[model samples]
Target: MAHIVILGAGIGGMPMAYEMRALARAEDKITVISNNPKFHFVPSNPWVAVDWRKRDDIEIEIAPVLAKKKIDFIGVGAKRLHPEKNQVELDDGRTVDYDYLVIATGPKLAFDEIEGLGPKGHTQSICHVDHAVEAEKGWQDFVKNPGHVVVGAVQGASCYGPAYEYAMIMDTDLRKRKIRDKVPMTFVTAEPYIGHLGLGGVGDSKGLLESVMRDRHIKWICNAKTTKVEAGKMYVTEHNEDGTPKKEHVLDFKFSMMLPAFKGIDAVFGIEGLTNPRGFILIDPQQRNPKFKNIYAVGVCVAIPPVEATPVPTGAPKTGYMIESMVTATAHNIRDELDGKQPSTKATWNAVCLADFGDTGACFVALPQIPPRNVNWFSQGKWVHLAKIAFEKYFMRKMKAGTSEPLFEKMVMNALGIMKLKDK
Candidate 1:
């Protein structure tokens, strides 16, 4: 019986374990390794940061949930990955052997790349639930004495949805508190345009997002490179389309949340033929490492080139729908190998995003995440906000139930009338 070990217990890893369990032979062992004992819904982190949702509301004890599926759970995080030896060294000085390893460990937040960034430094973050909880403290303090607010993503950052969500949510929250007029907000992004979103602006996304920001009276600066952040002050260099600096600005803020760039976890970084220069796992079409065939990867840890180059570097986002497709394909491919069949399944890599602006939200769909896609759609409405809330609840329920069903594939695609976009 083959032992398949999955690393990290976040969105990508949890679903991967469940899907693998459903596909693998009964005797095949499936183990999930995570540093954190509990699985927190990352999408809800923005809400948590604003006190709209609490930590306990989005967190699920991982051990208990995996136990119900008869999967082994290891809370000790990986200290190092020895792909050649087919073993993972744990922080507790133990090692686990695996016939096949799936590296779903999400990206390491590269806050240190910039001076005085991250929660410990100057700006707040909602990347993790803990960060969000800490950011909530800052949010509370800010509401009491509101002033200039800064929010956006930094250079080389991949995930842009949450940055947009948080900015709008904060706006909505401040309005509710009747303190919005006192808080002048500015959105600073690495993207070439307001709605680039690292996918070259999905179907009028540029216009739509810019319009929304205007309606909310939120100002934005694109092609912005955040050089340094100090307490209540940010240093920014705006770039021209030719990648030359156009202007410099020093802005002061009472509160701020900036998304940092992501890199592969230390465990897998700098491994030859395994990861890119930025430490993102290098995988072929099948989501399996070209050199380490037994190793597979999904989610933000995987390397995907930028949809288009801008003055300031930006990375493509691996949205939930794309990650779900990757997980499904990886599971099927591994099953194929066990049965002495060649791997054939490939992830569609579609992008479907819901950016909640608290009371109202926007949704974007790209059939193929890459440029010149088959379908590109974007829309905004209060219904999108309600849909996002329903999605959060449904996802949390799915995780608790230990089901292998693909949430986006089964529900989102059908609801969007784009089930045909998925590969059968």
Candidate 2:
């Protein structure tokens, strides 16, 4: 029996397991190793930070879930990967051998790079369930005495959606508490513009987001580079369009949240040719490693070039829907390879997202993955918010059941107008 070893149990890893099951033979065995026993819905993490949701409500035990599907599970952390030897070294000094390996170890937070920020001094983040839980506690303390609020991403950070999401959620929460007037809010990011979103502005995104933020009275600073963060204050310098220098100022905050830069998980980074200079995996168009035929990567773990050279420093975020597409494509290729068939190359990923603003939400859709052919559209309404909630429920339920249908996938793709078919 051929054994398949999968590392990490996040959005990218788990799906590959189910997809591989669909492709592999009865004699083949599937095993999953994750640092945590539970999987947390990362998108809902913003809600958890604002007390809108609880830890239990957003997470599930991965061991039970995977066991129900008959996949062997190892709830342990991966220490390193030996692609040449085809073995995964566990931190416990144990090893797991595999015929095929899927490296879905998602990005790790680089909080140490930034000074006086993160879990150490002040500033909150919605990066993980634990972080969100701790941030929620901080929010409770802030509500007792309303003060300054700053929400955005740090330089070189991808995953920008949550930063905007957190800002609006905080705005809404304060308004709900009738303390909006007590808090001075600001939106800061490394994106060059109000709506770049790492993929550049999707159709009407610039107008829609800019207009909405103005209406919400949320001050913003784009193309801004953060230097250091002191207690209750942050130092930042803005970059003019030409990458020239600009003066700096001290922005103080009583409560703040900033997304941290991400690096490849330590386990996979040790292997040669598996990652880029910044510590993210290097995968070809098919999301397969060029150096190791049996190894593949997807999700935030995969490396992509910076969208542009900005003095402030920034990188494109591979959104959730895009990551899902990568996993789906890899699953198909791996199954084909196991059957002694040639694998199809990975398809390019586009973006489909909903920006929930608490009272309402905004929708965005972009195509082609990269630039040259980009159309981003944004609209504000209560329905968008309701739609996002419905989608979240649908995803959790579907994941719990362990199946996502092809028909449903087609329907979603067509609805988003993201994928262009060759015509039936």
Candidate 3:
């Protein structure tokens, strides 16, 4: 009887548990370990910050849902990852042994890299639901006395989409409140250009996003290094293509939201041969650590290098579809190992993103997330925004239903000619 232990119950881990169950034997025990009891839709965090969504609207208690599928649950977070023994030390003074372990704990926000940079500091964040809620409070107080606003990703930040989303969402929200004119907005990012998005400008994204920002009247600073953030003031240096400082600015703002750089969670950090210097799990194409065959990883926890170098360093994004593909591939490979076969499945690493801009948005499809891709497309419209809303509802329902590959999702993706895995 094999016991499969999955750490983290977020977007990648939950579906991975369900998919493992679908592919595993009846006697194989499957368990999910998470720090939080509830599952929150991370994509809707920007809306929460703007008070367009309440906590309950985007979050659901996941224990009951996982229980319905006969999967054991542990809310106590992982204290240590003993890959050598194939056991996980839980925070509640317990250890769980596993025949196969999947780590999907996601990224640890690296806010300490810069002074006065995070929720506890001078700015607000929407990375977590709780942080977004706090940002909502900050938003409320700021709108009362509108001034300049700064929103973007800092140096070494990987998740650029949300920064873009929040900036546009706040703009849209302020316009609705009829006070947009009172507030000037500036976008500061680590990417060399407006739409590098860590995938090397997906289908003229540079041009499209620049045009969109111009239309929206939001100024921007790219290749920006945030030296420090003080109360109501941000010190920034914009770098030239040759990696030289070209411009410097000290911007003042009544409200700010800057996405922090990401590093691996502490549980697996410094694990020799198991992780990269940044502490992200080191996985081969099969999604299995080369040195630790029994261990696998998915989602933001995996190490993927930057597609190309930039003036200011940036990393590739592990998009929702790409992470889902990794989850599916890992589950299949674990099943293969159990059946006494060499692991073969590999995640496609495709990128499908729908970035909301309040009432309108941009959508992109990168066949392969790296450069020299086959199919790279980017488009924008209100329908994309509606699609994002539909996706949020659909995904929440999927988690509740414990359905990894829902029929409706397949149909929609098929209709759009999107492929999660490459054709064999």
Candidate 4:
């Protein structure tokens, strides 16, 4: 029996496990290794930062769900990925052997890259639920005596949705707490504009998001590189579009959370040809590693060439939909690999987002994240917000319930309707 080991339990990992199970016979072992025993809905994490959602509100135990599918679920962190040896070392001194391996560990926050930019003791993050809880506590502490707040994404950062979502959620929450005016906020980011979003501003996103940020009275420092973060303050340098450094200074913040640039998780830090120089695994359009055909990567863990290299560096935003597509493709290809047949399909990149603006939201759909492609973006009212809320709830329930179907396929297609509307 062929053994399939999937690393991680995030968006890409969970779905892959179920898909592989469906492909293999009962004796073919399919096991999932993850650090998090309880899966937290990542997209909704921004809501948790501002106390809009509670810790228990968004978490579900992943073990039982995988077990129900007859897949072996191991709740242990992967320490080392020995791709050459065809084994993975767990944190508990155990090893797993596999004929096929799918790496979907998501990403590792490179907080230490900027000196003192992370939760050393006082700051908080919504990247994970634990971080969100800490951020909630920080917000509560700030509510007692609201002061200057700095919310933003750091330099070399790729994922932009969380930063945008967190900024608005904080604003909304502060308004709810009746202290919106008390906290002067600054959104600092590596992007040159309000909505560059790493895909270089998805179809007029710059103007629309800028207007939104302006309407909210949220001040911003763009093309800013975070140098260091201390208690209640963060250091930054504003750069020209040429990426040449110009001005630098420290901004005092009462409460702050900055999204860090991502690199591949530590487990596969130095696997030859498996990863690029920047720690992201190198994969073909099919999301399979060239040197290791049995190995595949999906989600933030894989590397995609940058659309443009600016003076201020920007990486592509691999959102939920992109990751979902990649994992789905991986699932199908693995199925083909096991059957000794050629893969029928390869995943391509498509960008779609329903970015929430707290009270309202915007929908962005693009054929290619880079230039030379079709694009459509539209902004609407509270209906968008409600739609987003419904989506979050539905996806949360569906993820916990363990969907065997490829759901994002429908989402990607439905988003195409809005894309058509944006053109009109």
The C-alpha TM-scores of every prediction are 0.98, 0.95, 0.97, 0.96
- Kindly report which residue stretches of model 1 are placed more than 4 angstroms away from their true locations once superposed: 418-424
Q: What is the lDDT of residue 297 in candidate 4?
A: 92
lDDT of each: 0.93, 0.80, 0.91, 0.82
Model 1 worst lDDT run, 10 consecutive residues: 415-424
- lDDT by residue (tens digit), candidate 4, 1-424: 8899999998788888877787677788999999989888787788887778887888889889888888888999999998888999999999999999999898898887888867764457778888888888877888899888888888888888788888887888778778898988899988888888888777678888888888888899999988877777788899987778889968998988888888888899878889987789998878889998789998888898777776677789887777778888888888788888876667767777776767887777767667777654545567567877888788777877777667666666766765567568
Error of 1 at 90 (Å): 0.4
How well does candidate 1 match the true structure in TM-score terms? 0.98
The per-residue C-alpha lDDT of model 2 at residue 385 equals 79
lDDT of 1: 0.93
Candidate 4: stretches off by over 4 Å: 418-424
lDDT of 3 by residue, 159-230 (tens): 999999999999999999999999999999999999999889888899999999998899999999999999
| lDDT of model 1, residue 109 | 97
Best-fitting candidate, scored by TM-score: 1
Clash number for each model = 0, 5, 0, 1
The digit string of per-residue lDDT tens for model 1 on 204-226 reads 99999999999999999999999
The residue pairs found clashing in candidate 4 are 243-311
Pairs with steric clashes in candidate 1 = none
Better of 2 and 4 by lDDT: 4
